[model samples]
Target: MKTGSLIAMLFPAFVMYAQPGKLVWEENFNSNKIDTSVWNFETGTGVNGDWGTGQLDRATDRKQNVAIKKGVKGADSSCLVITTRAEEFMDRKYTSGRINTKGKASWGPGHKIVARVYARDVKSMGQGFAFWMLPDEKPVGQKHMMWPQGGEIDIMEYVGSIPFHNLGSVHYAWSYENNEWQSWNHAHQGFYYSFKDQEVPNPSEPGYGNYPPAKNDTIAGSWGFHDYGINWYQDRIEFFVDSTVYHIHYLNDGATLNFAKDGENEDAIEEINGKRTGVSEYSNHFPEWHPYEHNMYIILSAGVGGSKNTYGGPISDAAKFPCSVFVDWVRVYEL
Candidate 1:
């Protein structure tokens, strides 16, 4: 996504109100093992489809490339090093780990969500590390096929080659075609975008891929951990990085309504889906279609070789056997 900067005037105001304060859930990762109390491993080389067609294998042994390392801590206490191995694909080997709270720590219907995580040495794959939420139930078809309809909330997704920049989005099915592959359908979708000033690139305009790095001073990874957080409130969702607010979307607000209305333009609707379904039918697939009211589970995974490998191409074999994504901790709080 292209990046640009805009300055606007701001006024500060404050008011005080009384509210309850308490911890809802958390995982400090201090123990030598993954906290079973907060997470359960979703083991397996995932099946082919949008949910993730890549092979997601569980790591049996702990290595620097794909293990839980001790002695590493963010700003607070000790940290866990989640590594990736380059050993599965014939041409390339990219290894990573994935953990979720499908049944162990699912959050239902109402709750505020917040997590603090630090990632570095993220291998240059398109599908980098993700701290997101998904519905705990399996959709109608195969277990893996439950995307769009099953519900997905991507709080943070980073494409390795381009660090410091990220994406936050939500996906769900709009309709179906006779309950079959050829008949399956999805309509409107939207995502909130933001980036550090330096990392934005201009579109090629014609027909080429522009690879310009961010225009500002490069942000060093050695600068240490940055706080990535989200406040999921009933009326709106806000995202913050390093304590600075980056994006905000009001639930059922005018901005969302306009996006939905524009999506129904004949050209926009045709581009999204064709003749089999009408535009009105297509528009119903969004969370705005319903209320953003449902429980969700947290999922963290680093994909290696497979179709989802977004780091340009698979890691060269010579570079295999020694890559890792360190995590300080993952915590959730209700506000």
Candidate 2:
């Protein structure tokens, strides 16, 4: 039997994320070491140059950047910690850690992915962490669908600049005006949550009034170990925080897959017959051609910001260095 399969069968759960289905695989990070059989480190600026975000950090396999810590305060004694520092490395101004489960494990429809992460409130600035996924397989002997086309699922994202705010989004293909592809032409549905207030926010209109408040407790904890997850299906995806459903995106929302152009329906809502209905252009629906139907692998990373367009904005001298992201555990379930 494969090592990953054996580990799946033998390892038991430490804490449940409360998603539906049988636990099939998990990484508790309790062994005082990362399981290389299930995870791969991604070093340097990344494949798409700057990890597709023009971030300042150069990922490294050095212990200073990625390592497992034992006897962590809030976690079950051990956790995988990825730290980002302001120190220079290999000509890059910053260094951080990034890892993925590409060939070892991949899950498709009818599965739920969850992870327990703790990015402490250290007053750190100009950096962020993400628990996201991407397609595991490449197209066979055909044109490649880059990024937003192949599909991307951001289960959880935390930007230091936007403290206590969590974001979940899906990116997919969109119609282009011509044969040439444009980045803004990508279709996306993003959901936001304010961990401080336990409220959901409008993703499109950032300044809109807050949505209803959730009954759940604030995400703040002694060391802040919270579960972030997603229930993925063939036709929809559900976002979860501490097992509570925060947002749901359906694939058959009676919306068109492609938009004629960007900014046509920036509002994502329209009124008809005295009632407002979601504009098809901005609906959170997935088309059949989308790569969400295929299998995707998990990515856990802590990125440092440098330039104006970098994630979490540019780093300043006021920003603290050696910021850390502690991952208590990661698990997958079969729905």
Candidate 3:
């Protein structure tokens, strides 16, 4: 697995097919530096509490908040510049940039990813500029669990005030003895951080988890530069943007985890426990051990701040202050 310029992951099944856009893993920030073999810049803040965006901000190594630079034209070569300047230096006013591939490569179950972005201006409002995945942060049982109790893989979350909107979610911890939290979103072009945490616009319900919103989408424009993907398999997950197909994010529709209809899931178990509560309680909210069943890594960030569970409300003023988010390449395949 070693002996070349890349591709030496050895085990943990991170894929290795090699053809048909099958590069297994890539970064293409086109050399010049910031490669560390496959990325790692991720300083402080996370798990310090409030990455959900009460995000007053912090996470920097500062190359102006991480850079490879070549901007304004979008990925044909060098890209991966995450900026978010509004500084106050750690006491938190705004400082950004985060990178990952934790430990070095990780992926389990099938696996697929595509990056290439340009992201939006994010008009502020509790800013959340991301392209994510996390299950490799290590430490979780003797009590180091985190975020929806250690299970999240967003794929892309643009909320600079929801312009041209786009989101993809998958959180967990539906009640690990009441730590609560749950998810299953594909996001409506008007998600508003889960619509400011529900209890309003009711349509018989779906204002909370159990999948809804984004039935047939394509409208993903903001600052332009598209193409976002996710495949994952082993149960279900298939989302795309420039490659089409809007959303799927499942866990088995036949044996049942919440299939949308046909076999009936009571609107996905009454949006998770309204009364029926029984489908193994929705796979017991995943993350059963060892980084949610074997390796899983990759994170590219351009964050600013959000807390109260991201885009929770009130952050406007066009959010402008050097807010940027771009990345030209990040491949990963073999599913």
Candidate 4:
């Protein structure tokens, strides 16, 4: 494995904030070491497409990529450094940590879910990091359920190409006209929402055609240390970065229910009438809308060379050795 250096980002202070809720669990990273009591290590590569197919293969049973350390005096309380382990023939290399509270800190259906985190030392290009969650497991017969159906909520996702900005998205499934599972393609539908700096791509731009244009800036350096969080409830979900609300999603309801099915077809109508009962039902237990209601754990990792980067191609030759993602702490509250 190619040894890489890690850079740590320093923040000015340590602070915690909560609103009208009970504090259930938290990890401030102030112990100067990972608290094994709250987090369980996730070894090997992830079995999904979000972080690229093969990026996790480079992670081994080594502390070079993930670990806890004392904060630089006056800068941070404690820091978690994620470094990259280089590989031959592979133009890029990255390694990060993933910890989850699945059975340990799992939240039930009705409680609100929230996490407060500060991230920095992100690469200027060719890699990305995220703080998100997915269901711990699916019902036995429902193993076929994919992401949205299984449910995925992205509290904050930062692309290296646009490090200064973050994205918040919720994914779930919807029934289609074709009642049979084989014909579901024409009936499949979903929604995606993202927020970023003003310089980021705007899907609504006129004449932009199907593809959104890309823009770059030095702003990634300015995001040195910032707060990112999410407020998740049974009926709705909201995203925030540094306390600023960027996206709001009310669970799929009647007004927005039409898009839940594939296309306008007899099958679509029947599926809707059969599954959708009421606003509360649609918002709370509807599998198509809230497949992730059971319990979820958190994940944080870095990717080097994936589909998202353009200017730097798949890898950044200029990336200094030992790139790091400093996190102040992760706190979860119930609302």
Give the winner by lDDT: 2
Instruction: Name the regions of candidate 4 deviating beyond 4 angstroms.
Output: 1-18, 48-57, 73-76, 87-94, 108-118, 140-146, 175-218, 255-289, 308-313
Candidate 2 TM-score, C-alpha based: 0.77
Q: Estimate each model's TM-score.
A: 0.67, 0.77, 0.31, 0.66
lDDT of 1: 0.46
- Note each model's CA RMSD in angstroms: 9.2, 9.5, 19.6, 12.5
The lDDT of model 3 is 0.54
Show model 1 residue runs off by greater than 4 Å. 1-21, 49-67, 88-92, 108-110, 137-145, 176-184, 187-195, 198-223, 249-291, 305-321
Off by over 4 Å in 3: 1-62, 67-82, 85-98, 109-128, 134-158, 163-167, 170-248, 257-269, 274-296, 303-317, 323-335
Candidate numbers sorted by lDDT from highest down? 2, 3, 4, 1
lDDT of 4 by residue, 1-335 (tens): 11110110011011122253777776767775667787776755565633433343344335766777675433357766555555542322345456666656655443445444434444545555667777776566554445545556777666545444555665554542122233232221211122343221243221101111123333442245656666665434545566544444445442133334323221111111122111111323243334535677777665555543221125545444455676666766775
Clashes of each: 21, 0, 9, 7
* Candidate 2 ranges with C-alpha deviation above 4 Å: 1-19, 121-124, 143-145, 175-184, 202-223, 253-288, 306-310
Give the alpha carbon lDDT tens digit for every residue of 156-208 in model 2.
87766655567777776665222235767677776665565444533432331
